[model samples]
Target: MKKRICVLAMLSLCWGVTDATAAGPDLDGYVEFGGRLFDVDGDEAKFNEYRDIDNGVYGNVDILSYWEGGYYIDFLAENIAYDDQAYWLNGGRFGSLKYLLYYDEIIHNITEDALTPYDGIGSDTLVGTGETEPALWNSFDYKKEREKYGGDVEYAFENGYFVQFGASNMESSGVMPYGGTSSAEFPAPIDWEENQFNITGGYRAKKLTASLTGQFINFDNEDDSLTRDDTIGSLPPDNDVAKVLGKMVWRPEYYGSVVALNAGYSKTESDEQLGIVVPGETRNFDGEITKWHVNGSWKFEPIEDLDLKLLARYDDRDNDSTVLTTLDGNENENYSSEIFKTGIEADYKLSRNNRIDGGYHYLNKDYEGRSDSDGADDNLFFIQARNYSLEDVELRAKYSFLTRSGDYTVEPGETDEGYRSYDVADQDRNQVELEGGYYGVEDLGLDLEFTWFNADYDDTEVGLVELDHYDLYFSGTWAIQSNVNTGFYVGFERDYSEDLGDAAETTYYTYAAGLNIEAYFMAEKLRLYAGWDWAESDGKSEFDSADIIDTDEVEDFTQHILSLKGTYFIDEAWSVTLGYVYEEWDYSDDQWNNYVIVVPGSRGDTFLSGAYDDQDYEGHTGYLSVKYKF
Candidate 1:
């Protein structure tokens, strides 16, 4: 509520900008208001609309006011009264200082129709209701809301330099679903606060620009742990982070060279004690990360009709943190990686309408722990070419191959090499891609793309052995008339994995991924769009060992969406817009078929099953809005 008041006060200040002088300042604006309706059932919850509005009254404001040079105001607000509300307001001129303020709200509706057996849904304590029947379960809606507001102030000098100061605050309050080993799944409360402050200064020049920034971030959480049927350390405590970043981009006209450098150092630490972990003497996590990178690209015309380009980049991340160990001898982990990359390419013109270019790239990666199970080092090589030899057709292709080799396999916090498993494993990967774009006609455009990826694991035991992937996409847009336009798109993707290892040497799992298509037509005053997407993925794991068990989990779903909107000009300055939208979600999973469970707990209350998160559902939205612009 305080945030809302702050926003309202800011709005009031904006309106005051027009009333500063008796002569009155120039003011122009428009307001939009509309109504919408939607219906959702208890058993049928729409997770997609968790963060967005499914049904409600909608309103917006767009305004700009100015008083010559004294003061200027601009505000663009959307969904003003809804959960997904946001606005930006910038207005202020004090001597040479300028400022802007903005606010954004994000919401997650979660399950609107959750059936639980507990009361006090939003409070800290939850008491179970003895009702065991699914029909008699208590109903609740879980949601998360984050509110962020910030302002930025900058001072500019006549000599081409500026200094900026910014501060922001974000607060989150919500409930999430979590499960426990000894108890049924339940909702947990969340109350988080994050504050950030930063200062930046930059110098601007005709051929060079540079900036440096420093920031401090603090996160505080009220609910460090949740105590319901089971007391669990469910959240991380307060933490403070500080970082400094610098960036520079330089261009030397004499050699046509461009240089870019970016570097940063960040340290994060939290000393809050967690009583659940055997009440250790030291805090669990204290980490620091340092990042640095430099990139440069140069273009030179050594000869006529020939262009040469050279590029290089170096990036590294170094992590050093105090490792806190538990009484059981368990310790924290750390990772640091570095990369070096360079590439060169050249283009030669065969004629005014033809050109060809090829490039080679190399990348080497090194990590601190070369013996970790997930692979620690990699070297990649690539060569690519493009030929623009045809008047109406252009083609481009690239291929990359790489191999990975690691030292001994081991897991962190333990010295036992026998207990380590390499899932990604020592392997070879080959990637190929081709893309083409055609824009020969003034009224038409087309794009086609293809990609193939294959990975072979040479030495793997009881893990993913090999995988193959493919993707295809085609899209085009054509102008049917000067006042009409239409476009269509289609895409398909597939991935296949084979892992058949026995006991110490075998693993098996397989699946498939899908196709998306869209078409749209727009006229001077009418627009129609439709999209359809479907995906089916089902994989199972199996081991031949008598001690091993086979597992299966399938994911299958399809979504359909259709929208039509048209605007009719009542006059040169007035218009009306009518839009209708239809959406459908279809889901089918084998494991949760008509799932319903009600178990009487050792405590007096009954435990109930959660709602099917992705059940089939359809939605329709219709709106008629009027607008006036002068």
Candidate 2:
């Protein structure tokens, strides 16, 4: 709707900047109005999937103002009419000039119990009718919707120059889920558009700082292809991109050194005409790609609590597309890659609270016309330690190791004999980290964390042989007086994997948990807020030999959240707010909720869409708002 009338004309120009006159612009802002109610049982589009939060009529706006020489203004708006709306504005002058504007909206509610024997579902031509009875087909909702807007400006010069510019746009239309070829599946029809531009120039000093940048991007895909009868597929085309960037930093205070540099370049292009492949060839497919990167760093402090760093990086990619030939002689393929890195780091201080840090890294890769292996090498090492010499307690530890080697080839009927292609496979990795903190219990605060990970491919004989991960966390906070406060946190996670397929030899497992709680209360004008959250996830898969069959919990889920809010001032600036939100979800999948879409072989040859059995849901929301401040 014309972007909701340009966001209601920028909220009426930020409500006329609080009556722009008589030396106005000295406001502190608050305005809110609300109404919302929802009670969902199962799939209210999975509890408003990407939020529109049903039964509504809500409003909000926040403003900050200033105007006495260093002029300023800030505005914010949220959820005015739904679909996750947003708007923001920032105004200038504190140093020189500044400005910004923004707008955002999102909606991605997929699955409204999809089913389609197609009848132009979202149009780009789809017309299926051989409908093998899916409750007589025709019902759709696998959604998508996105919108973005932007603006920015910057200017300053007091001898530390600066200049900047910006532009942005994004749009997306609905319908998704596509895959076809005899087994069928289609809904596809998302007309996307994107555009962006940027410019920058800078210089700052206290040592030195410099910058230059230029960027441009464009993409358009108005249903590039989707014809369903004789089957035609192909979407996502039309592209263009360009970029250039440079940055530099230097500091030299007579012997204290630091230098940094960065560089970037990019190019991408795509032009249409994808028709005849190799018969009377008159070629097309003139795609292109080019990219570059560079980075450098240096830091120093030769002694006394020592600190040093040196780093380097380089990257490149080129695939100047456009290749064609056939009639038994193959062609029409392109690929490229290059990457290099070097590193050194150190930090030391042995007493007065202890500290240590270390690093070493090396990486290399080169490939051309890749088909699984061409080159690869990587190495990494790390160490870290820190202690705050007790007092209020603080500690940290870290360890890391990594190794990767590759040059394993197989092309010529590609992949299927000792496969090995986990990104050029031959891997070994290990990591560990730990952290702790305590504030000596005055108002109480504590935290703890742990992590570990491992990976090994042991000379791959088919594919991915091992992987593992684990994490744990704990937190606490308390105030108990002066207004009361509380906090809590908990987390746990684990993941494992092993794979090698020829028939069966798979093993996978995942587990997750999370818990959170927060509370706050005050008495003087009455205020309270509370929150609770819990989450869980589980997954499993196992198989052995002799024809498979050891599978059951292929991903299970659980989630819950609760929130409450209360506010009452009625004096200071007038306030009133009452809010409640609750959410619960549970899902299970052993291949998308164990089939039966009107049965008919229960989706064996595909053509099923029960919307994943409507994902369990339970939701409740309530709101009431009124606020004013100056």
Candidate 3:
């Protein structure tokens, strides 16, 4: 709605000149106010569309100020009642002539509840009625909003050299819930705008440092395609990209040797290309793309504790397109890719506490597309060891290995269920990691991490097969000396993969855990806090069809979070805070398991009823805030 009335007239002219800081602030920075409450329940748990479970009343502030002479201003706000929001405002000028201005707004609520029967939801074409037909199925919430304005400036020189420039403008409006097609994925319609410009120049010495850069970007699409609440497609056009960059770091000896260099170049195109081109097409899509890269590094310490390093990199890409025809004489084939890398690393100090490190890397890639991502070439090796002489206890170990050789090129009725053998394969990879910690109480500390990964293309004949990963983590913290402190954390992750063809064959994994605690007593002006977190994700896919037969599609989610806090001071500038937050989410999906409204036709189990069940929710939030310093 006119961008929410121009953001409510810029927040009512910035809260009508700061609403007299609610009766405070007579010059030196400081102002805050608050009131918050929220109660939520299941069903798409506000899914990010702000609304976070129907909350109410929230006003809190954190500001930075200076107002006179050195001019300054800043405001930061977070989670202000629903729609998952965060806002920021800025003002500048401090010292050696500086300048700044900024504004930000964000809102995203992906799915409060999704279900559609196409009834022109947000216009631009939508009409449904295909097979099985039963119609009337409404329930939508998939939203997005972003608005931004920017500014920047920097200048410093006394011979140390420095210069910078910046620009920005962004606008986005949306309702893209994974836009339809590939078998009916619904909800799509977005307006866009973006503009960017940049500049930089630098030189710092004490052993050299240099920089140079330039950039320009543009993308504007106020709706130009998409049609599939019923059918019609072809979108994403209106593009522009340009870049130039350079960097260098050289140390001629001020404690040794170091050299670094980086380079870049870029180009992307779209002058006018957004669709419809019937008749020996010259353009339906010939979108241009170009790229370039260069990197270099060298470090030295040929002796001493024994240290040395060197690395090199090169990359290239080009697809300056122009050959898009088909109206009886097909013509379209343009591709390119190139990459080369080299590396070497070393560090040795078998004394002090023992140490060892090693590295070797090599990569080369060249492609012409089709068959997933063409081919691949790689070789990597690593070794590590460290022992902190075990007083507070500390040890580390690491190992890595990799080998891959390509050979893939599928195109000619691309089958295997439309393959994705990216980087062809003849693979073999292995990794092991371990980290340590133990700072024998002074404040207390203990941490450990473990990881193992393996990959084998199970006798590749094209695409996926056997991949495994595992991880374990532990954390600890404690302090009782000055007031109080506490902490705990746990984590585990595992993933497995296997491949054999199309339609389905997927596996997923994720796990998380956390805990936190805080304490401070009277002498410290009172304070207490608590936190807990847990996460889960699961997935299983196994569908192989040629007209229905086998099945096994499942997706899941589980989450829980809790937080509590208390603070008191009311002196030394003032302080007051009380907060509580609780959250829960449980979700399941057999790919949008039944919600009745019928629309199945061009194949069996059309996503069970067309996905979007991301439901289940619980919420509670309470707040009272006050903090100031002026």
Candidate 4:
């Protein structure tokens, strides 16, 4: 009710200003409550329905408090209450001796639409039906709220400097999912608002340090459910950004050494509404972007276990020029682009058991916005090794390489002196890894690892393909007595594919296993754990030949999981937790049998492909909390 009477009038104005400032020293904080439950199974009906409280529950409640002293006043609060009862509050603070203020608020009362299939349209329908879809009952109960307030006041001197000015006001509203309605029962356009501002300066020394800051952001969404006033015809529009930065550091103790320098610049203006089609629609003008950088490092020992090092960096960018339109308004303006980069690194310590390292990098780019005058270049390399043996064993290895080439532009008034020129694709990549370990059992333990990868691409881009990979792993652990502990692991992975217009190549593999156990009763506040996992996969494609391109069959899937977790310490301010999970999925590919369906005008919404063809899923969770400290 009126947010619990504004959190009891800010906790009675923070205890009436701490009993009229009884001379400092008094701090307090408290409050918490919780809830969560989720159960899901795959094979359609949108992936096991929960369309908002059809029995399954989701609940929560929370209220927070805080206070501090020494420099006078400080207090904070956060509130949240839900279970469809709806409530929100995010926190704020106020300071004394003159002035200082802060504020933050977020009120969300989302009417469970099964949490909108977990955002981003159920991850684009699990990348187009690799499964998961279902949950749209009524589908239009959404509420969003916002409140932001800021403050700053400065006047300090002890031998340091400070200056400040800050301001903020942000107000937001319900259901604005960018895009005109399609379906899901519309009714959400509760108006909108946004605002921001800042200014700052600082300096400190014992060696050297400095700072400066600035910011501005504003927005006014004139109804129409947040920005859509005639799509690109503007109304209460906004977009502006500005930046500046500088830094420096130097240390010299009779030339023992340290040095640093940094710089920055930025500018931006908007109102094009995000567009990029490079053949007709290309928006992002009202431009200005610039950048620069530099770096340095050094260290020395020149003895003992031996040590050495070095490093470097550089970068750049620029753009500005407008006029590009589409969405049936058609207009264009000559474009632009540019980029550059550099790098270097090193390390060594060939003793006390040996060590080595490496690095290298470079990149370049230039293109007069689309009409082709393109450019490209990239390169990298690396190496590493280490060993320490006398029987307790330990070894490691690594290798890496990368390469690239340039020139590309296709379609859109084809340029670069035309003639259909758009070929400058070349790439090569390689990687290797190896590892070994031993801890001379006294508690029993072991580990092993191996990896390899390769990639090649040249003058080809249609579905661009070429890659090879491999991996292997093994692990072990045991202490079957010290409060009990155990572990196991196994893994294998492989993938090979090549198809540059029917050069045809395919291969796939996946296998895994895991197990873990742990226990430690009373003497450790109580603890328990369990884990198990398994996985499998295999490959081929070409269905309905629309220029033949389909792969992913021979899929044998298996999954089984069981877990029970616990923690209890009902004494030092209270604590309690319990968890249980069970999972099952097994499928013998028949291309998933076209994923059974029957919910278009529901007859009790059906889609049970054998309920996951070997189904068995269950989940139960529990929590009890009570905390208090002052």
Candidate 5:
């Protein structure tokens, strides 16, 4: 009640001011109040039971009242005096009818997990004595705050000529530690902050338009957290980067309608640090990297029913590093790369309801590792067709081919400097797909799709490789009534790979099916849904050992979700809503286990197989919200 009174008082104050001046500016805004709760359960033993509680009262208020004779002001505040995890303020103005200004500030809190790679130390190596290592895991949480302010002013004439200029600055701060440790173990957490500023100006005419924009970013480390001997040292500070872009458009009624041209330039620079452990001693290395890119594109309609586009881009990167060792050793290494890409595309309408499109792209990259340089090139071409009939049926088909060649470099031995390199050539791939959908039935639909892919790789250092894959899928949905519906889908995929020599090739296959049912009631405000999913994948791969490995897995999962929500109209300017949701994820079989090990590993390889071990996950979220609009 107190909060409501405060809001009403503020609204009344603004209204009083507006009423006094017949020519005053208009005022408008809305306020929202709500809260949320969540819970999670999984089969992996590591995540058998997890709970997160997030509940808060939030709202926003904005006042845009102007004085007589062309003077205006606007103010906005949100999450006002609340314990919730979000807050912000924004306000701006446009003088009379020509100038503009604005500013905003926001803060947020997020909870997540952290996992760091094991630098081949201890029992975490993939080869040698300590092979098949486990990843280190820890729970993480952090808070972030961001602030920005900028605005643009423009003068418009009855003519097509209009000019505008604007500039903005943004800043953010968060916690970043050197070593991938949980927040609980940090003696002193490093404060990380970054700032960016940009300025843009443009002009527009009847047949031509152009704009130029430039931006810069700087990152700094405010506190040092990691010690020299702790495997992770203090992070670098004060990294500066900049980018500039220019765009132009031209449209002449003569050559088949609209035509536009665009061009841009970007550059980045950063100083990076790397830590290595030699025997029992630790060493730190410093490196400087610079990268630049130039790109351009052209678009136009060459015919009455055809559209064409052409694009090209070039990028160059250089790295210079100072290597340091525990034995007071120092050396310098340089790496450079140049990459180029170009592509052309065309789309043509065969009829009023049918269309066809095709594109071709080429990429070339030359990389210099130390004193040696290697190059790789790739070419790709694809074409697709789509047709739509009056009966509510749609069909699509596409085919693509890609060929690539390249050489890669790596470190060979244990050294603070460069050591290993590999050369690769003749890598090619081809793919074909077809899809169709039917929606002629009232509140019912069906979809089907199939894809086939093949790839071949021939390398002198890594041996020859060949791969093939096929995929098929089907889905359909039916609306039992205006408030109820049901749907189901099934898919199958297979992959086969072969290598040279007596090394046995590997094959993998996956099959999945799912069904969903949903019903809505209470004037479409309340909804309930239930679903079941089953999937299985089997494959074999060659481990570090000479022997061939085999893998077989299957998983069945089900989820039940229920939600109830309704809105109550208290008055013309006020309303309230109550809502709740309950969901669960149940898993059965080894398929879930494989997914936990592989998918999570890619995110810093922090796979906690134990996290989802023997149990399923259940979550419940509920919220109540009230909104007032004027």
Candidate 6:
């Protein structure tokens, strides 16, 4: 509330300044006033999941003013009285100096119907109740709020040099569900903030350009631990990062050649206090990680209708965390990784409307102090063809193949038995894609796309075995006249994966489809618009083993959205608009539908019904607004 008040006061002051100093033909902008009403049938949280779209009054203001010396100011404020509000202000001269200020707020609504059996919720400490009755529990909502404010400035010199600086701070606070020591769940408090700063300088010339940047970031958490039912758990710790980056691009005066280079280095560190300490161990832990990368590319045209490019990169990460020798009698693993990659590509024009492209790439990764395999290497090859020889028609097709090999030998005492990590497993992947577009019909346009992908991990005995994906999409648009148009799009997708385990061999599948249609009509005095969209998805998991049984559908969902609006121009300087929106959602999950709130015994598991329940809703909204331009 204090933030909102400050924003209002600032806006008022700006208006006062404008009224006092503005002369004729020096000011121009628009202001809009509006109000919205909502009618909902189900949970409100589902309707306003990541935004604040409730019944309220809203206003928007935009102003632009300039002086005779190439100086100007631009300001905009939106959703003035709502939770999802934003404000921006910027001023500068033409190609000389510029500054900016901005602020925004967002609300994340998790759930509005949740029940708990603990006292002192949303605090550091919580008390337990022996009773396991569901009717006697307390009800509360789970949500969070995030706010950010920032500003930046830039200055340019006449000698092809420029500098920019920026800073921002963000804070988040709320309560969310977390699992406790036992089978019970609790709502935990959250309070954290992050601050970031960066500065950059660059030089621009006709043949060469270069830039360098330095950045620093810090993060803090107010509550480091929580106590529930005689058990204490540690939360997120304080951390910070500092980094520097540089980039350069140079162009030679021969054969349209170019060269580019980039490099960066960063380090992150964290400190935390231990909740439970041994007799001979320290009370705190300090951890650090460092990373660096360098990459470069060169492109040149060797002859007529031929172009070639080469690129390469190297990356490294080092982890140096505190060892727990005094407490556990074992040293911590470094868990570091390094990567090197190189690639070459070529493009040739068969004719004025025909072209072909091909590329080959190789990558290798190495790991230290890992229980899994040591590392993996990959090789990829691809080719593409495009043609625009037919009048008003275009076509494109591409194919790619890749292979991966890893060292799967396990160490005797350090590795898990009969386990293979997928990240370093032996695999083969293939993909194919095709796209086409036609504009031969007068005032009509059409496009179509299709894709297929497959991955086989045949060498592994107890991990992912196979994966497949497919997609198809189509869209079309028709322009009946200069001021009238309509368009529609549709898409279909499917994904499948198969895995092997000790007890059962499981396969998971998902399928989805979506459609959208839109129309616009412009008249002499009134304009009209309409849009509609619908989507549906379904998922299933099956187990094929001697001792396990398959199950029914795991999840299903559907959504629909419709909107209509019209604007009536009373005159050149004033207009009014009326709009309506409708949204419907239907969702279901098999696990949540059969879950029990509390078990009967003292040693049984307990749960809060509100934390993971399904949401189904239908909502309607209407708004009216008037705008004036000067």
TM-scores for candidates 1 onward, in order: 0.81, 0.31, 0.28, 0.23, 0.66, 0.92
Q: Give the TM-score ranking, best first.
A: 6, 1, 5, 2, 3, 4
RMSD of each: 5.2, 29.2, 28.9, 32.9, 8.8, 3.1
lDDT of 4 at 464: 40
Candidate 3 vs candidate 4: the lDDT winner is 3
Best by TM-score: 6
Query: What lDDT would candidate 3 get against the real structure?
Result: 0.70
lDDT (tens digit, per residue) of candidate 5 on 1-630: 433444454445555645755654565666677765545554222222222234555556665555446455444555554422222222233432354444444545332343222232211121122223435433343334455555556654455445555555555554332233321122124345666666666677778887777778777655432432244443554567777777777777675545555555555555544434433444344446766677767777867888898888888887765544334564445668898999999999999999999999999988776432267788999999999955788999999999886654432222411222223346788999999999988989999999999987654323446779999999999999988899999999988876543264666777888887878666654556666666666665543444634433334444455555556666667877777766665656543454343223245523332222344657666777787876
Can you tell me which runs of candidate 1 are displaced by over 4 Å?
17-29, 40-56, 65-72, 91-98, 115-120, 123-138, 180-184, 272-375, 410-424, 440-442, 499-553, 598-614
Over 4 Å off, model 4: 1-103, 108-141, 145-151, 156-162, 165-175, 180-197, 200-240, 243-321, 327-329, 332-630
Q: Considering TM-score, which of the candidate structures 3 and 4 is the better prediction for this target? A: 3
Q: Model 1: which ten-residue window has the lowest total lDDT?
A: 505-514
| Backbone clashes (count) for model 4 | 2
lDDT of 3 by residue, 430-514 (tens): 9999999999868899899999998886345435766888888889888866677888888878776666534446676778888
If candidate 5 were superposed on the true structure by all CA atoms, what would the RMSD be?
8.8
TM-score of 5: 0.66
- Report lDDT (Cα) of residue 628, candidate 3: 83
Which sections of candidate 6 miss by over 4 Å?
1-21, 24-29, 67-69, 180-183, 274-283, 324-332, 409-419, 501-522, 546-549, 599-606
Error of 5 at 546 (Å): 6.5
lDDT winner between 1 and 4, please give it. 1
